[model samples]
Target: MLNNKRRFSLMTTNSHSSSQKVGTINGTKVNEMHAVEAPLSGAADEAFVTSLRGRFVEGRFVYRQIFAIRSYEIGPDKTATMETLMNFLQETALNHVTSSGIGGDGFGATREMSLRKLIWVVTRIQVQVQRYSRWGDEIEIDTWVDAAGKNGMRRDWIIRDHYTKEIITRATSTWVIMNRETRRLSKIPGEVKKELVPFYLNRIAVASEEKDCEKLDKLTDDETSERIRSGLAPRWNDMDANQHVNNVKYIGWILETVPIEVLEDFNMTSMTLEFRRECRQSNLLESITIPTTRVIGESNNSINRKPHLQYTHMLRLQDDRIDVVRARTEWHFKQKLQ
Candidate 1:
């Protein structure tokens, strides 16, 4: 079992000292002063190395991590992109499993799951961004998992400014197991369930009342508002360890069909995505978007409301036209930010 008393630390490089204490985990001290000088090689460099500092908290049920926003993670607006924030959520969730002592070699798989050739796959995810973190900013993220229905798992995350402690984002997702060999959905095995039950939390980061509450509409090509982008193909780097296109890549493709005018005038406040099928590197895809004037959950009488636009998106194979993902996004006027 991990030490429940572990605390977070923000480490800095000191020119005067050879090494400095970063933090403690399971009663062992960690130092990162030398790492700053030597730097990491290969997939991650020095800049990426300094960004990740994480630990377990709340009796080890919740995982908290502090990430320094790197220059590469930010966009032209000098703020972290939606894709960057999603990547942080993914990395934190995987680290949580690794620290729990129940993880197997497979990404986030338990021992029983690895033996059974089962891997977790997300079914749906929703993210609400109240504010975007800027480059050089440090943001703290807390994530926890709970039971979803009888066999599925629900994960939630809350991101805040590390210094001000102001909430920046909230996200929630649902996942289920899939058999690796058969490529089919599977129920939570008894042994795997036993491994996870101890770490499950009853907390929710994104409230249901705050969500649209209505199901995400499955958009078809015919329903799109005359905006479509075709001939999209996955690059080699887009594939994950599981040999499928990474989920975050789908978000980029979905936005490809969105009208440039909408992208310029509005900022995406929330996005809901439903993963229906996996895409491979060999598959060619098309993106479609449907513009809608009516906001799904907003009230007409709401006070101080900013102009909002909603969009429905679809990504599918270009040849067979098989749906890979369906999504909905809500955007608010950029003037609100000004």
Candidate 2:
């Protein structure tokens, strides 16, 4: 029997939402799981305040379960996962918070006096996964208020084991708050401010498989002069449940451009790419990458020169800006010579 328990939010006192009940039984898949409107764990305002205030001071939080990642977060392999690498970051951020004094609203609301009037809504979210968690691993999750930008704030979170405390997933999300009536970006109010200030992640870390890596700025080699040839067109095999080009399949597109000797020499080890848009099966795709020769920051690794270089690549359809729907990929490169 599958025992599914839902996390309760102190605010709203609403019941579990239908969206939270996704699960399978006897080989039968249930599309949309439903939950009742739960009650607020406490007064919405006070509870919200306590949640943020604590994070601001101590950086602690009661983990809540959101939706599961149906797909692996990492693009290349499943042996390594977003969960294990980021347990430290997510766990640390969620566990430190306190309501000491006055500052910006910690959770969602803004300080009308300290900042401006607004409610933070997650605007963008991105995740890279090396592996996916096996069934039965109930993930622990939490987040920190990342920032209060022009009219809203941002937060970051992660997923990990409830007991072992191993990270299984990592994520960063941007949030925005708008005026209650106008639906426009607004400043937070004063009472919502935290006496303590929020902090930023110094760097974006990727699970790398290469010895030396390069950045996008210097990685490119005369892309404007390149005339890439199309290999295979999309077939039914390339479509996913979403009825579009499967996300990981985009990595295969980039792999096509790499010389077979290069692909064979260095297996992918680590990568980072942004999905400015997605491609449908209808489009003929294009592969793009920053050449290794253009790489900087990394010193020559053993095996002559950087046994394997870390990499970042992207896949897109022709007229990418016009046709892209939701697409992005990251890949690591191994030096074949090594």
Candidate 3:
């Protein structure tokens, strides 16, 4: 039992969502795709679930899940939206936690936090996209946990085209535990520590360096080569379970200003976002994108260097111009799809 002083929150609510029938991705059954909030009968059940999603690769538990790009998941160009890729990554993480027995069930370490009124929040995340998966394309996301600070944990992913096995995107994220009642950051509880520590693997991360997530340039009118600003209003369905506009929805808004030529010939290679505030219903937001690079610099011999373009993005209140999120994206020209 955890002492009240050590326990961060006093939440004791126990609730479970009705399980929905598993749906298919590409003519394949994905039934059991929903979250498991109750513990499995025994270790044998756990092993079976783990094998279905992914397996242990040496020391790390690697989970593989497939996502088929639906029409709604694509942009006007008919390629997968950045938000869709992000959703797949987020779902994979949830699945990983549930299957690991660290989360799921109203009984484990993760629920223990909820039992104590604590919740996990993402502090930062960075993604590097090589190519956007097209509609009808099945993509495989391989996700694993990496060692983070004692109070937090890091997760990384490699997304690939399911059939071709070509890498499409790489992402990494950092998460911290927060008290729901006091709304303050908290250390990992002993229960969670014991459950998560053994799964931490010393492996090369997708977003390798700590500094990659640190600095996101603020958008300003002064610096620019090309720029676009679009008005954005969140729809009713854009809200998530938490009632605020979902984080992935912000990615779609940010990409609205990316040049059509870039979207057609090149691909978004890297993106970093610093979420400063949350937007609720009735917030009128402006999605602004400003290209920061002037030219694709040529090498010493005048040979063409890879086309590199950087754009700074901001989601701001249209009325007051208050910032909700600031992000930066890097793009690379692609010769052809692999």
Candidate 4:
């Protein structure tokens, strides 16, 4: 068994680590029940360290971290909500970039863009989950970067069970730098590239050969389609420290357009979202959800299995008809609690 101290060391290197542990019983250490078991030989120890520290691949330094699913993050099914996992991945990405010396208030400090005051923004993300982790589950997330367009870069992550190492989810996201004042996309600066080139990875996080990551089916103003249009304006609490609508709030608004029957009966299996523009407190947007046909087959037959549904959702400005976000969601029947 790995000692509690050594395990902690593997998960974090900084003395001022922000890692949190959950699911502790009365008078027991947080890691007591999470201790890993492996051989004590030198080779085994080295392998364990590599897995925990995450080695570089194709020049990308993969960072690994563990998260204990807290009670508040779970839904009625006692499993972590999709939004919660997204938050974890988002935070991990920020921490990774910060440690690389190119994050936070110093986003573009190395380049002239700093003079213009630029910030990195997530343009798109696709997340697929094989399983939703229950409360108290300890999961590990490994994240890295891939070469992207000259103006943007791609980041990817693989989340897994810390004990069994079963992959729980895979995600890929694209980000671009923008001038805070102008609110316009900016070119990747040479100095920024200098800091990131050493860690660029050639591999992708999820395998989607046929799907185009850049283009998502947007909600059209088709009267023939069953569309749910609702007013969506952000509240003060929905805004983040960045002075923009929190990304998680977008997910909630998108779901608001989903049919109540679907929301009550189904569990979201996967989602691919493209954030075209940012939303502010003053912006009045319309949420639109267009449900695609239910592809019923053996997989969705009620006699053989549960039903599945898919929807194409979007958030657009009510006044100018500009798209703020476009996304696709897949859901399946949720299992009843025993």
lDDT of 2 by residue, 73-117 (tens): 433333323333333333343344322232244332324432444
**What's the number of clashes in each of the models?**
0, 78, 2, 0
Question: Which regions in candidate 2 have their CA more than 4 angstroms from the true location?
Answer: 1-63, 66-138, 148-153, 173-215, 218-221, 224-271, 275-285, 290-307, 315-317, 320-338
Candidate No. with top TM-score = 1
For candidate 2, the per-residue lDDT at 159 reads 58
Candidate 4 per-residue lDDT, tens place, 1-338, comes to 44431533222222233444333435565443432232245766666665544443333488776787999999877899889999989777766775565554643233344554877788888887777899988888888886687778899998999899988788888888887888888888777777778778777877766233545766667831565565678899988766789887888888877888887787777788888888999998888888765755457322213237878888888889788999888777776771
Candidate 3: give the clashing pairs.
Answer: 9-116, 37-105
- Cα deviation at 302, candidate 1, in Å, is 11
Superposed Cα deviation of residue 17, candidate 4 (Å): 30
Which regions of candidate 3 deviate over 4 angstroms? 1-60, 76-78, 104-109, 181-183, 207-214, 220-231, 295-307, 334-338
> What local lDDT does model 2 show for residue 102?
29
Compute each candidate's TM-score over C-alphas.
Answer: 0.82, 0.38, 0.71, 0.76
Candidate 1 has its poorest 10 consecutive residues by lDDT at 1-10
lDDT of 3 at 36: 26
What lDDT is reached at residue 277 by model 1? Answer: 92
After superposition of all CA atoms, the RMSD between model 3 and the true structure is 12.7
Error of 4 at 129 (Å): 0.9
* Candidate 2 lDDT for residue 56: 38
For model 4, the superposed segments whose C-alpha errors exceed 4 Å read 1-60, 104-116, 210-214, 223-229, 300-307, 335-338
lDDT of 2: 0.42
Per-residue alpha-carbon lDDT of model 3 for 1-338, expressed as tens digits? 12211212222223244533234545775444532234344666655444446555544577677677889988766788677888888888877777676673422236677677776667677887767787888777888876577687888888889778988678887777766567577988887676777777766446334236457766665643356564688999998654568778888788777777888766676777777766877898988888767456552311123437877788888888788888877776654542
Q: Give a tens-digit lDDT track for model 1, residues 26-139.
A: 556556422222323544443234335567788989888888799999876778888999899999999889888999989788889999999999999999888678888889
